[model samples]
Target chain A: MTVTKGDVERLIDASIGAAPAPTMDQVKEFVTKTLDYNFAMTLTEPFYIKPNAEILHAAGKKLCTVISYPLGSYTHEAKLAQLKQALADGADECDIAMDVSAFKSGQYDKVKEDLKPCVELMGDKVCKLLYFASLLTEDEQKRAIEMAIDLGFPMLKTNPGFGFSTTVDQVKLAHDFAGDKIGIMVSGGVRTKDDAIAFVEAGVSRIATSAAFQIMADFDK
Target chain B: MNKKELAKYIDQTDLTPGEPYDKITEFCKDAAENGFASVCILPTLVKTAAAALKGTDTKVCTVVSFPLGMDYPEIKEIETKEAIENGAEEIDMVMNVGALKGGDYDIVNDELARVSKACHDKGVLLKLIIETTLLTDEQIVKACELAEANGVDIVKTSTGFKKMLPRSTSVEDVQLIRAHIKPETGLKAAGGIRTTEDALKMIEAGATRIGASSGKDIVDGLAE
Candidate 1:
C-alpha cells in the first residue's frame, strides 16, 4: 500500500475555508488557495457556501457544509431545514452532527427518529454522521456507531475536533462495525501527515483537519 | 449583589455538545439546589433538565441555532417551538452573526422576530445571543437595535464559543449593549464569565442575566 502525497491529497477534507471571522476578501483568497491545492473537499459553513460555490465548482472541488454542527442537539425539523438549506446553498456534501446527547441519555429511539429524515433527505449526497466518539464510553461509542450504521448513513465521522481528539481505535471500531456498509471519516487528533496516512490505512474514507495544507507539505517528504 | 440575588441572575449553562448524561443530571441538581434562574443546556437535554428541576425554582433553558446562527428564520422558529415543547422555559438563540457582520440586517431581523414570536407564543423567554466578541461597536449596537425591535425578551452578549481569540464578554460590551438597547429589554452577559467578581461587574454594567458554566463557582465565591 504505497500512499503517495497525491493519494493523501485526494482523501483530505480541509476546513480552512471556514476559518473564523474572515472578511469576504480573505475567504476568497483562502478558498482559492484551497481549491488550487486540489483537495478532494473544502468544508465551510452554510453562509459561505453560496458565495464560493462557483469557484469550488470551477476548481472541481466538493463543497462540504455542516448541519447542526458540533452540537447535534437541534430538533429533527431544524436539522432537516438545515440540511435542505445547506444543499440549496450549493453544498455538495454535508457532515451532520449526530444527537449524541439523546443517544447517551439512552434515548435510542429519539436519536434514530431525529436522524432518519436528514439521512433520507441527503439521499445520494455524502452525509457523514458526525458523532463524538472520543467523549463517549466504549459501549456508548459502539452503540453510536451501530446506530449510524443502522440508519444507513453514507458515511460516519468521529468527533468535531475542537479540543475533542479521535484515535485510530475509534476509527477501527467504526470501520469494523460498519463493515463496508458505511464509510468512516476521522476529524480530530490528525495533526500531521503521518497521522492522516495512518488513519487512512486504519480504514478512513476521509481525514478532516485544519492542518490539511501542513499535512500535504509534510507528505511531500 | 447578595448570593441569593446573584444566583437569580445566573443561567447555569452546559451547552457543551455530547456532555455525559450523568454530568447533565448532576448539573441540573446543582442548579436546582442553588436556585439559579435556569439550567441552560443543549436541546436534547432540555427534557432531562426539566425533569430534574421539576420541583425547583430553576427553569430549563435550551439553545437554538446556537454558537452559529446560520440557519434560516423558519428553521430557528421551528427549533424554538420544539424546544419549548421539550420543556425549555428560556431560549438563548444565536442570531445570524455572520449576516450581521456581513450587513444583512434583514436576515438577522427576520430570524429574531420569528424566534421571538415562537418563544413568546409558549410563554418562553428568548435571549438573543449576538456573539459580541465577533462584532464591532456599531455592529453590536445594530444587533441590539434588531433584537429590541423584534421584541426579543433579552439581548445576550456572546455564545462564549467564538472561533477567534478573546472569546469573553467584557463589562464594557455589556454596558455598550445595555446603553443601546431599551431598559425593558433584558441584558445577559455570557462567554468567559467565571468568578464572582466578573459576574458582579457584568451585573453592575446593566446586565440583567449572567450566562455561565461556572454558576456554582460564582455563587459559592460570593458565599465565601
Candidate 2:
C-alpha cells in the first residue's frame, strides 16, 4: 500500500479524539505540535462553564456536551434543565438524543409533535440530533433522515459510541440521503487517520471522536 | 368566514393544571368577546374552553407534551385521543429531537406517526415544532423534512425556548420546508414573537401560525 505523508497526516487528523485535560504543560506541547483539528471534552460532574471556557480557549478548540444524555427519556423539565446548564457553560453545541422508544413504535405524530418544544428548549444553542443509525436499515435510515430534516436539526450525527462503529457504508448512506439538506457527522470508533480523511472525502462535514490528540500527534511525528 | 381572516391569533395557553373551571372559561369568554381566533387550552380543558366559547369564532388548540416532546407512542396516542375527545381543534406536539440526534430514525418515525395518526384520525390538525433554536441549521432542515414526510399539517418554529428567536420564524426554516412539503402543510413561529414586527417577520418567513406567551402583545402590536 502506498502510504504517502498526506495519508498519514489525514490519519493523524482523524485520530484526534479524547484527552485528559492535561496540565498547562501538556496542553502547550500539543498546541505547539498540531493545529487543524476538532477537539472534544464531556462535562464532568457539576459543570462549571467559566473554568471550561478558559481551558478550552487556551487549547484553542470548541466545546460540546450531551444533554439528557445516553437516552432522551427525561421529562421536558429535566432535559431543559440539563440544556440550560450546558448553554450557560458556553458549550459550542449539544448532542441530544431524540427519545428513541417513541420513534421506533411508529408513533410519528407523537415524535413529530415534540420537535418544536425540543427546539424551543434548545433556543439559540447548537443542537445536534444524534442519529444512531446503527440499529436501523438503510431505508429506515432514509426515513429517519427525512424526519430529522423536517424537524430542522442543525447537525445529523451518527453513533455516540453506544453501538457499532461508524462505518464507511453507513456514512455514505447518510450522505446520499441527506444530500445538501443537512450536515453529516460521524462519531464512534474513529480512532485512526485513514478513516477520518475517508469520512471527510465521503462528504462528512464533521467527525466526533476521542482520538483528536493522536490524530494531531501523528501529524507532528 | 375565513377563520384566519375573521379574527386575529390567540394562544390561550394549556400549561395550566387541574379544573380550569373558572379560569379557562372566563378567559375564553373574554377572548371570544374580543374577536380572537382561538383559545388554546390543555387537552383536559378542550371541552370546557370549547363550550365556554360556543357560538363564537374562537377555536380550541391543545398540546400533546406541553413543554417537552419526549414520551412513548402509546402515551402520546392516548393524549391525542383525549385531546380530540375533549374537543380540541388543533394539536401542537414536540418532536423527539433526542431520538433523531441519537440516530434512531425508525423510533423518530414511529413516534410521530402514532401521534399524527391520532390527530388526523379525529380531523384535528397537527403542528410539528422543530424548536429551531435548539437545532443547528442543517438539523433544522432535516426536522422539517421529517415533519413534512409524516403528514403533519404544519411545521412550526420554537416552543418558547431557544437562545434567540430566529428573527421571526427564520425565513430560512420556512423556506427550507416550503421548498419540500406539499402546499397543504403550514408553518408556525412561537417564542419571543410579541411585537407586530415579529409577527410580520414570521408571516413573511412563511409561518402560518404564531405561538407566543406574548400572543396578546403580538395582536395588540399588530393593531398599533
Candidate 3:
C-alpha cells in the first residue's frame, strides 16, 4: 500500500495536539528530514523564516504560514499588506486570523470588509481562516461558516491557539453545517491520532497539531 | 481599458493600526501615482485617502468590524454608514464564523443582505469577507451561494491570522467555487499568495481579485 501525503497529514494531526511552532533552526532540520508532516509556521516578520523549496524538495513536506498574524484586528489595507508579505515569504499555505473583535463588537459590515485586501492578495491561492471565538454565539458561528463558504476557502479552522483548541462539538458543527462546501480542520487541543480521527469522522479533512512530528514518528504498529 | 491595463483593478490598502495620518496620505499618493484599483483605508482614514485621491479614479475603500466577523446587523449598518460618510467607495466586511458553525444560515443571510442594502443605499459597492479558512467546503459553497443571492459583489477569503479553515486554498476548492458562482460574481483569493506565479495560479484557478501586502512585487512581477 502506498502512503499518501494526505494520509500522513491526517494521521499526524490526529496524533498531535497544538503546541507552539518549532524554532527556525529546528524547522530547518525537520524539513530536511523525509516525513509526511505538513508544517505551517506563523511569523511576526520575514526574518528567520526559512524552510521552503529546498526543504520541500529534500524532505517532501508542505509548509503553512500566517499573514497579519495572531489577531484579525488590522484594517483591510493592512491585512492585505500582510497577505502579500506572507506569500512572498514562501508559505505553501496560509492561515489567516478572523476579526473576532469586529464580529463580537457588532460591526457586521466591517467584518466582511476585513477580508477584501487579503482576497485580492491571494487571488485563488490556498488560505485558511482561524475563526477563533468570533462565533461566540450559534448565530455567529453559522455566519462565519457562510463567510468561509462564500470566499471559497477550503478548510474550516477551529481555533487560532489563542484560547480554546478544536473541540469535538466545534468539528461536528463545521461538518454538519457545511460538509459539502469545504474540509473541516481541528486544531489547538488535538494531540493524538484518535483525537484527529474523531474530528475526521466529524467531517474534518485536516487537523492542526504542533505535536505532529512525534505523532508520526511514534505511530503504533 | 483592459482590466490588466487599468490600475483600477489594483488597490492600495492602509489598514495598519497605529499608522499615522501622514503615512495614509503617502499611501494615497503612492496609489494614485501607481494607478492602483483603489486605496483601502480605515474608516477614520477614508477621508484622508479620499481627499488625496480626489478627482482621480482611485476610489477609497474601508472596512467595518475589521478582521473580526461577529457583529449585530444594526452595528454593521451603522458602521457602513460611517465608512461611506468618511468617503469610502467600497466596503469589505467580515462574516460571523460562529453563527455558521452553529447552523444559523438565516441570520447569516439576513445580516449580509442588510449590510449590502446599507452599502447600496449610499451607492457604495460591498464585498463580503468569508474568512474562508474558518469554514468547511460545504460552508464555503453555501457562503458563495448566499453572496450571489444577495447583491454582494465579491467573495473573499481570510483575515491574516486565524483562518476560516485550518488549511489553505486548494486548486480543487477554487475550481469548485468557480463552477458554481455566477459569471458576474467575482472571486478573490487571499492569505498566502506572494509571487507572480502564485497569482497566476490563482487567476487560472478562477480568482479575479487578490489581496496582499506585497502589491508592488506582484505589480512589478506583472511588468516583468
**DockQ-based CAPRI category assigned to the predicted complex of candidate 1:** medium
Which prediction has more favorable DockQ, 1 or 2? 1
Tens digits of lDDT, candidate 2, A153-184: 87777765533478888889988877888877
Best by DockQ: 1
lDDT of each prediction vs. the true structure? 0.83, 0.62, 0.63
Question: What is candidate 2's lDDT per residue for B1-224, written digit by digit as tens?
Answer: 23334236445454432222566688788777667756766554566677898788777877765444544455556666776776778888877655555455675678689988988887888887766665667777778778877888887776663322333456566666666667777777676666767667667766666666555555655542
Give candidate 3 misplaced runs (Cα > 4 Å).
A1-221, B1-8, B162-171
Write one digit per residue (lDDT tens) for candidate 3, span B112-162. 888898888888888887766666788888888888888888777655433
- Model 2 spans with C-alpha error above 4 angstroms: A1-221, B1-6, B9-20, B161-172
User: What DockQ does candidate 2 score?
Assistant: 0.02
DockQ values for all predictions?
A: 0.53, 0.02, 0.02
Q: Tens-digit lDDT track for model 1 on A125-195?
A: 88888888887888888888788888888788898876788988888888877789888888876889889
Error of 1 at A75 (Å): 1.3
- Candidate ranking under lDDT, highest first, comes to 1, 3, 2
Interface CA RMSD, all predictions = 2.5, 16.3, 14.9
Report how far residue A66 has shifted in candidate 3, in Å.
Answer: 24
